[model samples]
Target: MRVLVQRVRSASVTVDGEVVGEIRPATQGLLALVGVTHEDDATKARRMAEKLWQLRILDDERSASDVSAPILVVSQFTLYANTDKGRRPSWNAAAPGPVAEPLVTEFTDALTALGATVQTGVFGADMQVHLVNDGPVTVLLEL
Candidate 1:
């Protein structure tokens, strides 16, 4: 499993012109673009979620786990896109929807289980996401 964690002042996802999920301002939060591969399992998914919670990227040098910040999770299989040898990116490293959807759900659930106020984008849906990146702070988490 892989997570691209971005600190955001606010974030939201829209599907078919309807807002599906959002995190309001005045609260510190992480926007997580999560990905999964065929070899990924629940254990690794849980570990990555735990790391995101414990990551000390917020002000006051506090981890999200310390303050229970909210999280916005979006399924992003493109994280595994490979463009090494061809003009077109290869998605071979990404798991198929049947294999990936459950892991995505698991990752989000793991974060929620860790006490995060977790929001999520619809899996396999065409989504428009908006965000105000705080400090432009971003981290890639893997396990």
Candidate 2:
């Protein structure tokens, strides 16, 4: 599992002109782009969720757990793209949809269980996402 976590002032996702999920935080929060690989499982998802909740990248070095911040979770298999051999990128490292979708859901569910307000983009959808990045802070975690 790999996750790209961005601190954001607000974020939202829309599909076919309809808002699917959004997070309008009164304070700084996070936008989590989740990715799953063949080796990833529920345990990795849970661990990633815990790390995202406690990551201290927000203002004043406060964590999302510390400030009750929200998180917008979006599926992004592209995080595993391989561009080493040719001009075209290879997606062989990314897990297939059927294998990945459930793990992504587990990650979100774990975050919610940890008392974090979680928003999500529809899996496998062509989504349009908008976000106001706070401090332009971003972190990538791989497990």
Report the number of the highest-lDDT candidate: 2
Taking every candidate in turn, the Cα RMSD to the unseen true structure, in Å, is 0.9, 0.7
Candidate 1 residues lying further than 4 Å off, grouped into runs, are: none
* Best model per TM-score: 2
- Model 1 residue 95 CA deviation (Å) reads 0.5
For 25-79, candidate 1 gives per-residue lDDT tens digits of 4768889999999999888888888888999999888888887778999999999
The lDDT of model 2 is: 0.94
Candidate 2, which ten residues in sequence have the lowest lDDT sum?
20-29
lDDT of 2 by residue, 3-51 (tens): 9999999999999999989999998889999999999999999999999
Candidate 1 lDDT for residue 111: 87
